[model samples]
Target: MTHSEMITVLSQRLRWPEEKVSELLSVATEVIGDQLSEPGTLSLPGLGNFTSRKSKEFISLHPETGERYLIPPSIDLFFRVAPALKKQFEEREEE
Candidate 1:
């Protein structure tokens, strides 16, 4: 779900005001972003991991023209689902 949708759900489930939920969400996201910017991994228990990786410069091909080009190095973010979380989802799917 989208951020607004998530906030709405949390507001209803926790009986919290939307404004409060929004503020908490904002703070949480900001903290996560800060940690990732530090080039570190942020792990959430029973959830997943958030990490960043720096990719080396590489050559690329234009799909339309098949022309070759150089792609600059960049940092990329990734997420890996926790095993417990994955198991819970798999169990739900089986049901």
Candidate 2:
């Protein structure tokens, strides 16, 4: 879902005003971004993690032109679903 949708849902479910929820969400996002920008890992129990790692610069192929261009090394966001979330998906498969 979009960020705004999340904020709306959270506001309703938590009984908080939309503005308050939005502010909290903004702060949470900014703090997470700042932490990630600093080159580290953020682990949230049963909620996966956000981490930064080094990668080599390489050429990337253009989908339309088939031409390659340089892709500089950069911080990438990697998300691995927590085991609990994985279990939820596996159960859905059974259904």
Candidate 3:
């Protein structure tokens, strides 16, 4: 779901104010972003993980020009959702 939709649902379920829900959503996303930008592991219990991979620099040819250039190593983050969340979706789908 989109961020605003999540905020609306959270506000109703938790009986929190809309403004507070918005703040909470913002903080959660900000924290996740900050953590992923670094080279480290983010392990959430019951959830899976967010890890950064260092891709080595390499030279690649440009498809059109056939020219090669040094490509910088980049950090990539991957997420694996919890099995419980997958099961929840499965059960919902069965309905």
TM-scores for all predictions: 0.72, 0.72, 0.75
lDDT of 2 by residue, 1-95 (tens): 99899988999999999999999888988988888876678887788887876677999998999999999988877877789878877788542
Candidate 1 lDDT, tens digit per residue, 27-64? 98998887787666889999999988878899998999
Worst 10 residues of 3 by lDDT: 86-95
Clashes of each: 0, 0, 0
Clashing pairs in 3: none
Comparison by lDDT, 1 against 2, better one: 1
Candidate number of the best lDDT: 1
Q: Residue 82, candidate 3: how far off, in angstroms?
A: 2.8
Candidate 1 segments exceeding 4 Å error:
56-73, 93-95
The alpha-carbon lDDT assigned to residue 60 of candidate 1 equals 100
> Scored by CA lDDT, what does every candidate get?
0.90, 0.85, 0.86
Q: List the residue pairs that clash in candidate 1.
A: none
Per-residue lDDT over 38-73 for candidate 3, one digit per residue giving the tens place of the 0 to 100 score? 888898877788888777899999999999999999
lDDT of 3 at 19: 100
- The TM-score that candidate 2 achieves is 0.72
| Ranking of all candidate structures by their lDDT, best first | 1, 3, 2
